[model samples]
Target: MGWFFAFFFLSGFCSILYELVWLRLTMAQFGVTTALTSIVLSMFMTGLGLGSWGAGVLTRRYGQRVGFPSLRLYALAEFLIGCSSLAVPAELAWGHRLLQSMTAQNAYSSGSYYLASGLLVAIILLPWCTCMGATFPLAMAAIRSRQRLESKRSFSFLYLANVIGAVAGAIAPLFLIELYGFSGTMRVGTVCNVIIAVSAFALTLGGRASARSSAPVLTPGERRAVTAQPKVLLVLLFMTGLVTMGMEVIWIRLFTPYAGPVVYSFAFILISYLAATFVGSFVYRRFNTGGEVDPYLSWVLLAFLGLLSLLTSDPRFPLNTPLRVLLGVGPFAGWIGYLTPMLVDRWAAGDPDRAGRAYAVNVLGCILGPLLSGFVLLPLVGERAAMLLFVVPWMGMAFLPSRRQEALPGTRMGTRIAAYASVVAALALFFTTKNFETLFPDREVLRDSTATVIATGNGMHKRLLTNGIGITQLTPITKMMAHLTLASLPQPPRNALVICFGMGTTYKSVMSWGIPATVVELIPSVPRLFTFYHPDGATLLASPLSHLVIDDGRRYMERMPEKYDAIIIDPPPPVRAAGSSLLYSKEFYAVAKERLQPGGILAQWLPFGDEAVQSSVARALEQSFTYVRVFRPVEENGWHFLASMQPITERSADDLVRRMPAEAVSDMMAWGPAATPTEQFDRMMRTDLTTQKLINRSPDTPPLQDDRPVNEYDMLRHWTHYVHSGMRNWKPDQYGAGSNPPPAGESAQKGNE
Candidate 1:
């Protein structure tokens, strides 16, 4: 019995570890878009739901009639789970190769590619995910036979262990990935599964002769006597599952902007959710009443969650304090988490078949929730409102009439009227609420699966906002990215790749060169907003030599077959943004280096504000290339890293002007500090930084990687420095900027005005 408890704990731990690593792997293979994330989550839940249902049917029909012990079946399921762990990573790699090959066939459509990839992901995850579901039923059967406790009570013990293990799962990656990387961590999970399988088999060996013979434990009359209206209970549980899972998606979107879109943000949300759930389930076990809950109290609690969620998710509210961590996200997670496992625990009544049956229905609800939240709700209403509106289902579920209603719901005229009034008041307050969205007017809003893009400005200038955080505005410094890289290359560039397409500034400048240029952008809405900022954006996009593709920057480089003379990347601001480290990782630089032609120049934009991040990125770039040089693009806090295999030499603006093509020279002068190459060259000469010295600035600082993203997960270390010292920004004072000072420039700042 003790061994079985340990096995369940280990199973829960490995389950979460696999989920985190698999999601990372999938994102690396496919672009990180809303549609892709939703598809992956839905497929995972669907496998679990089906597995639960199939196991229940088989247990009731065959195992009940023979001398089969459920412990043996449980052992078999654990072994199968272990077996699938070995195949998951291999299958993902093969899928990437297959998808890349099929992309070459012009006869196949992009839709077909997406469909095939999704199907492949589903096939890879199904076996392992299904076996995960079967463990619950099989374990319950063994517990019920060996122990003399109520079947309902045993479920709570196992659930508590599982949720506790999940807390470890959410947190282990921060350290594990830093030590082992993604592949090594997956291997660790595989070993844990083997231990779980072995423990289960050992238990089976001891009980081989003592296995329960096939016999109907509970007659129909007995089952009906225990509970009434099974279908209604199932429906209520389904709605419970739906609201809880859907709200997670909505809350993640709501908080990303404030949380800097880092891995810690997602990890914090999930950890708090599971931690709260563990507490909720533990409380349920202590307060067990052996009866259906009073339906009147349930409705009131559900209604309360609806109202509280509004305050919790609103940005205008003062939720930035440290306590905001608990106050902001815990309300909805606590209430919903408490009610779900208890509902399943109560409905199944200690019977393994009935337990599996009810839990399967709940898992199916989880399958659809993320899909609807990501695709339909977020795109239509935005994150805050979408989060508030989804609570309507819980309200409906609570209002549902129970067979035996306690507390006299809808009994007295005044009570019923007052209840209805309160519900209306909550909805009205949420609807007319003055959040950041409702308070600000006259802003252009665009929504898609990836993000909510808001455009705002005054008079002649404009700014782009993604999920309420300022991404960037129209700026001339962006032009330096295009012209400087082209002019500095040993040979005149024939073609280029721009990783981020912001306001079409870089792309437009690249297009002016009259060479083939492909711009890869992650957010679909970002590219669509191009024309609003640049009137000539449509014209430039129509050029035969220009192309815009929506893709993840790293994945694009990996799957790309062609080489380019120059590859320039301008990632979105606040380097710590979730998944942003992928663009700065040493592994990514290696891939980009391999894709660059001989004498090719790869330019990376590093935004200053965090020295820790700067040190990590600089180290990654220095490690990847043989020769590297850094230059401050303007007087601002950002630097451009120029790297290549070939030796790089400095040249004056006059020297560049003498070699520049007539049209190329015109493009260079169109948007920078200088009207001629000589003027631009003078400003660049003042700000050149030695790459090796910068790498040594923070010695032994770890470089960012896919698994251990130093930038994404190290907020605590960085914030500690921010709290005590008066430093809000990482100043460049340590390394002097001016060798030969250029006079104050106003053309760029004036245009920004």
Candidate 2:
């Protein structure tokens, strides 16, 4: 029993580690759209369901006839999962090359592209994930062969150990990824799987040739009676899987405003869910009586607890970020943990074949949950309404006849009263609470498959928010992103491209030059709200010179054939936002370099970051391009990095002004502290800082790359810094005691407006 517990604990850790690394690797190969993410996850779950059912059928047919050791089969499954750490990455890279080749010959439409990539991902991941699913049923069969009494509750025992390992996996892997890269982290997972495989094989060395079965083969009539009783229990298992996974997607969108969209925030949510689940499973194991809790009462409690998220997420509620997540998601997740394994135990009754089929049914529901939430529910109904829809199913199920024995006398009356009160409370929460978007007085809210976009505020203060996180506000710094890069070109610009269309200021400024300007935005709803920011937005969008592309900026550059004289990228704020590293990585720079005309400059906007992030980004650009320059916009406090293959020759403010057309010059001064183009450029020139100065700030930091997102995972470094130098005394922008100041007369204020 101890050996089985240890084996499952290690196996669970490897599972989560593979999931985190594989998801990131796929995003780098395929485009980083919501649809692509859903495809990857669904394919993974599909493989799990197929593997569980297949392993069960094989075991039930051959275990008694062949006299084979089930531990050997369990060991083989672990060995294959370990080997996937190497095979999966190589397969994904090959798929990427294949797609690129096919698109190069004949461009595929968006729907066709997803279909092609999804098939490729399914082929690459299914076989490996199938092996992962086989571990559970194979281990359960091994337990049944050796210890007959323990086999009756084997699923719950293994589930308790697996979930404990999952909680550790959620928190510990971030540090592993920080110290080693994604590939290196996968190597660590491979080692753990190998250890589990070798240990399991060792346990089989002294086993008997003919294993004793747990229960006698059932008669035909008894088999039918056993199967008939568990039909309702399997339905409950499927519903639990669907609602549990579906709400996880909604929780991320609803809590991003408070959590700030960092990797730690995601970890916090996962840890809260798994840790609470561990407590629930532990309680069930320790306190189980002969009579189980009534299924009807459990359903009623789940519905009531599920609605608590509305109260916790309301704008008027005054709770901290972590507390809000724990309170909102913890109770519901813990209840699910208690119900799932209990239902499986009741259905299987020590039979591995029945347990396998029941678990597979639940996994099938898990496959569709995220897809339904992301593509259908979120896009059509928004977050608050979507949450209510998930709760409705549980409320409906509470009225169904209970399959378990009737409760003792007097308990039925109390149960009905509790159910009525809970249903009333859930309805009250639905009508009373205000969603995050409704809290804004003047706002136009739009929902798409990608995100919930909000355009709010009055004139000159208009802002764009994606999923409740404030993305950008109206500002002159956006105008400078276009003008400064174009004017720095050695030759007159013929065309330009802008990635990330926030408030449409940069795109509008680029169009003032009368050159063809293309803007690529990830969210479809964001471009529709462009008219809310500028009165002339519709007029500009209608022009032949303006082109709007709805796609990921990095992926757009990879597939498109067009080259631009100037390419400007303004990533969303907070510098450490999850996936923001994709825009700043060296791999993205290499792709941008291939799409630039001669002397074309790439302007990267850094809203705000600490010295470590600044140095890592600077080092990546320095390695990718021959020449790089850094400038601080007069209207904003962050740096603007300009990189090009050809040297950017020095020019005075007057010379820069002479190069721009009359319309471009007029647009540059429209929202400026300087009344003239020359004065605006001169003010920008005064704040010029060297790229080397930034690199010197954090000499030991490595360049940012797709495999190593230093910005997203920095907790260890921050903790070490805090220990050596008190965090209260160290400010993020301060250069410490001896570091040189920014160019003379430059303001030291640290964030974008």
Candidate 2 C-alpha error for residue 509, in Å: 1.0
Instruction: State which candidate has the highest TM-score.
Output: 2
TM-score of each: 0.87, 0.94
- In candidate 1, the residue pairs with backbone N, CA or C atoms under 3 Å apart (3 or more residues apart, or in different chains) clash, namely 64-214, 261-578
lDDT of 1 by residue, 636-691 (tens): 54678899999876877677667667776776676555665677766776778887
Model 2 over residues 212-323: C-alpha lDDT tens digits?
5534444566467567663667877798889888889998888877776777888888889888888888777777633253446678778888878888888799898888
Any runs in candidate 2 off by more than 4 Å, and if so which? 208-225, 289-293, 401-411, 731-747
Question: How many clashing residue pairs appear in each of the predictions shown?
Answer: 2, 0
Q: How many backbone clashes does candidate 1 have?
A: 2
Taking every candidate in turn, the Cα RMSD to the unseen true structure, in Å, is: 5.2, 3.8
- Using lDDT as the measure, the top candidate is 2
Q: RMSD of candidate 2 to the true fold?
A: 3.8
